[model samples]
Target: MPVISPNTNYIRPSPYRSAAPPRSPGPTPEEPLPQPPPVVLDDSKESTHEPCWALDAIRYSTIVGAFSLTSADLKLLKKVPRGDYEDDDHHDRRITRTQSQILSRHGQRIDFGFGSSGRLKHRGMPMYALANAPEQELYRNMSSGGTAVMKPFSLRQIRVRFLWPLPRGEEPSHEAYDEWVRVDPLYTRVQLAMAVARVFYRFVEANRLYLSQYHDYPWRLRPDVFYRVWLLGLERVDTNVFVADLKYVKDYPNE
Candidate 1:
């Protein structure tokens, strides 16, 4: 099966705007949060299901290590068709859709743009829903209204962006450091939401497989049956611990 293309420049282009929106009043306006460097996964290995599974195993291990999830939390995740994580275009679409949903929510809008240093600059909202909302809420919003085949590499890269704390700003001023500190929690929320969305997306896709087994001949699965199966997968997650991980993430030292 095709895996994510070898090209590693996976960051989606910043959302387009006619002109910069007016800044809303909030805590001392934060300098744009520092951006993470591009992730370059080694694609030298022969393209095969084994290599894909290896990468996916690493991702699952990383997720289990970072959060308070049991192996059982991913019961549904394991069911997703392994081949779905190979399309580059699908990855782009999902990322774009996710960004649009977050930015459109009722709150101060953020415009991500390249700085002179060629890094992402988060400008506009001091406290946006992406940073402030509960991870589960964000996940629910993000997971719905979209269907895209996501690749492991793309998913891994996106998670890394949110998983770790942002780098310190260049300015020596305390304000910059304060801004990083404030923005860290926001990332924590987004990180979990994005993870949830990833898993949810897989469950949605897995519906195709689940429905197929019921009949030897191809038939359109009823919407009710389709939704129920997908939702069942979600219901299996331990949301309490999932949310508690928010606090855990805050205290967890950033390496």
Candidate 2:
């Protein structure tokens, strides 16, 4: 697996814009609630998978077999298709095509660029459906013209930037410190997620096992630029692996 490349200077370039438009004068303009970081995992903390009779009893196939094997499996089972003979131009074109397709997909939220400090600035899709009549009215017009829903996709680096609690000169400024302590655990969980994602990217880049294939990794376009790309669970699906596999979940839910 191409893991996170060691070159810290290598910043991922943004792709298209997010599918969801920014919420302006809407969505309460409240800062997202802050959370904690994640606990690091080491070999000693890990455990073996439980024996599953289900694995033996069930015949799992993709929705009609997306592949006889996964890409990871291909990395092992098949020969690394000798590419020394292939022309670089031919391979480059194929990669570009794959990235273009991901960007053009209907519900994809592409991240176009970052702010001066490297913050993901714009989203590409329909604006959040504001309930304020005026704001909602604007969304309705955009939707009529076939606007995108919430950001369609996310980027690998984009993180969630929470709203700052107090203005720089607010009175009783230290009060929030007490509250911050209580939420330390949540912040830890989020950081753990970012750390794993950081590792995963290197695996992808180093081994050159690309999901994007050509363009940059298809991370979600959330508020933060270096955050996870997929939604955790806005809703539940019967067979989604994240829902089915508890261990893969990176959440530290706030009460």
Candidate 3:
């Protein structure tokens, strides 16, 4: 029985003792991170600054006729400087308020018919030509004694002055004062010239109807002729920068 038991005593191996597979080597140390390119700052020299007040004046004059300008008109025409005004002590606001008051006054004056008074007076020139044709010698046969000497009608001259006030209580060396003094006149003149041109054009248009009534009166209604005459007179006048001699012509008829 002992021999039989020994023959049957064989041992079984455990299944839970299996070995693990090896892992891949960790990634080789990554190449050092690439450095970024250096940034370059510009160190160029700045150009010299030039004063703009005079340049602005010349520009204003070329586009707009040289004429007397109001404070409000000048303010409208001025090229306002660019900058932050939050810390400007409200000077810009004060000036704007003052300009508004002046504009209000101007509008009030216009409402009282003062704006068109001169225009109306000038518009009556055609009627004047009709009444005083013989005395004024406006036509070839127009004369007190039936003279036939050909002559043209005289056009009324409109002269506009360029007037603006310089700054007071400020030294000439101050930039603000210099700008105010130079820019104000320039802007005023430009605005005034525009205003004059508008008025003159309106006057011509209105007189066109009356001037057409007298077709036999030698002088015909020609806006181009009137404009040319005006330009000629303006160039001749030294005191007035804006002058127009609006005359009727015999060559052209109203369209």
Candidate 4:
């Protein structure tokens, strides 16, 4: 081989010269980095937010039973009226939109993330992770003369745990464990109505109703309806109209 001078400017030729030009590197900072769209989570699988009318639903149900429910409530429990959705210019667009969404997903399997009896999975979590238990009431044990404390069997327990502590001093004699555990009929009835409202909402959500439809439904899933209205950016004017018009009874505090 001929001796090559180290000072020569000869460059080694690349075999890829005949190949296609290399791809451009990613966009530079000056080019705004071609920002990707923000990630949006699909809340269609679960309820985006609990309803706003839950307390009112409970309060009213306790007083008048089925009479407390509204036309929308009945529709949710049974079937949506043809006129409710047929009108494009319906006064309440929220309802119309919700109905449209439900119709769009006429057939699909829905997983509510909980069992049919409304019990949530414990998965080794503390009871606090579960839904809050309902308030306990005192029931008079006519024979024992000692008042029995009881509460509704809530779907919110982490396990089959009794939240209420048994009486310390006097244990009322009963033929069965459930005898003293018997809850107020009115309370149980209201709780069942609340359960119905929840199931119905899940049905609507499974059918692809807008996640925002949580508020549009007649019943509120959480107690803070007004707060949710603000958080969801829903107009108070519309929400005001959605409020159930049952006369308030001072005796039954909206507790």
lDDT of 4 by residue, 164-230 (tens): 1111221221001000011232333223222223322222222222122344333222222211110
Prediction 4 global C-alpha lDDT: 0.21
lDDT of each: 0.24, 0.21, 0.24, 0.21
Candidate 4: which stretches are off by over 4 Å? 1-187, 208-255
Local accuracy of candidate 3 as per-residue lDDT tens digits, 187-215: 22222223334434333333444334445
- Tens-place lDDT digits, model 2, residues 1-255: 001223344333222221113432212224443322232223443446623321211101111111222333222211111112133321211112233444354432212111122111121111111111132333332212222222233211222211111112333211110011111222222232222233333322322321233232121111211111221111111111011000010111110
Backbone N/Cα/C clashes per model: 1, 60, 3, 5
Cα deviation of 160 in candidate 4 (Å)?
Answer: 26
How does model 1 fare in lDDT? 0.24
